[model samples]
Target: MAVRLPILLFRMGLGPAFGKRLLLLHHTGRATGLDRRVVLEVVAYEPNAGSWIVASGFGTRSDWYRNLRVEPKTVVQFGNRHHAVTARFLAADDGADIMARYGRRHPRTARRLCAFMKLPSDGSEASFRDAGRAIPFVRLDEARPRLP
Candidate 1:
């Protein structure tokens, strides 16, 4: 089956429980200078740190990630909530640490995430080590609720 089914469910307001937390992200394309909307999973939320973490499973090849790199300021929507924020690309070391912690806390989900990212299984330290290079992390900065 195509992964499109799961992605569709999320877009249609279902299946967020099954590893797809639908996120509506708005960014400006660097080359096109047009607004873009993307759906992504929410990897982690750190209220104390005032940031939310996301992973670019497609690495630098993903368009959304590339757009954010060119223009850090963007808008995000989680469920019914929306916010204006800045995106910060995490270093390889930091991404590894975050992936390690996530793998430890949610092994099964982590493994699934690894598979989705087309990386190796989460049970392998080698895989976790490789995630830094394979899957990069992004931090949402200066997040403020979007006005309805």
Candidate 2:
């Protein structure tokens, strides 16, 4: 229910408005080889590197995260643009840095996200870092030209 609505909106061509903040990830089932899709929030974007950072809010056990671990190649749709990208899991230390930086910009949302992820955090850098280390963060790097 929470994800179905956004998937519908993106399908109906309303994805561009959300742009880099949210993306639709297209991946394949590790065992089934069937296509799967999910809408995920963008934790951060690096313009120079053409990369988007995202986390498995449900931890590495999340289906999508597990699938990506089996096959790192995937596609991402942001707004009206689609890109072939590769997923790379970040190290715990790197995730901590990213979370700390994110907390500084969106403190409230960060707190809420931590709660939603069942991660304990008191808004301190250390807490956020610990929470980050507990979850899995992936960096999606553009692998090819934009899709039509």
Candidate 3:
């Protein structure tokens, strides 16, 4: 019931309003072989590279993270834009830097996110680095358009 609501809204085209802050991930379940969808917060976006950095707040055990490991090819919807992407796991140091940068940009939200994830963050780069090491980060690189 909870998940259905956002999926409905995203499908209705309200996604763009959230911009790069939120995205809908469409991935295949590794175990069930069924399609699955989830909404995730975008920690950062590299416009030059057409990539987004996202973290597995629920840790490495998150179904989506696990699923992506099995099948890296996926699609993400941000606002009204849909992009085919390949998910790549980020190194612990890189994830830490991403988190630190995100905290600087959105302090309140970052604090809430850390709290929700049961991660401790003192709003310092080092503290965020510690938390980053405990979780998993992935870079979703947008696939280039295919030429026919």
TM-score of each: 0.75, 0.92, 0.90
Name the candidate, 1 or 2, with the larger TM-score value.
2
RMSD of each: 4.2, 2.6, 2.7
Taking the tens digit of each residue's C-alpha lDDT, what string does model 2 give over 50-81?
78999898898889999999999988888877
Q: Could you tell me which 10 consecutive residues in candidate 2 have the lowest summed lDDT?
A: 139-148
Tell me the spans in candidate 1 whose CA falls farther than 4 Å from its real position: 1-20, 116-118, 143-148
Tens-digit lDDT track of model 3 for 87-139? 99999888778878887888787777788888888877777777777668999
**Alpha-carbon RMSD, candidate 3:** 2.7
Q: Whole-model Cα lDDT per candidate? A: 0.74, 0.89, 0.86
| Candidate 1: tens digits of C-alpha lDDT, residues 1-148 | 4655644544576544443344667789889999877667777875555567888878888899999989998877655455678999988888888888877777787788788877777486557767655688998865653333
Q: Where does model 2 exceed 4 Å of error?
A: 145-148
In candidate 1, position 91 carries an lDDT of 88
Backbone clashes in candidate 3 total 2
Predict model 1's lDDT versus the native: 0.74
lDDT ranking from best to worst?
2, 3, 1
How far off is residue 130 in model 1, in Å?
Answer: 3.0
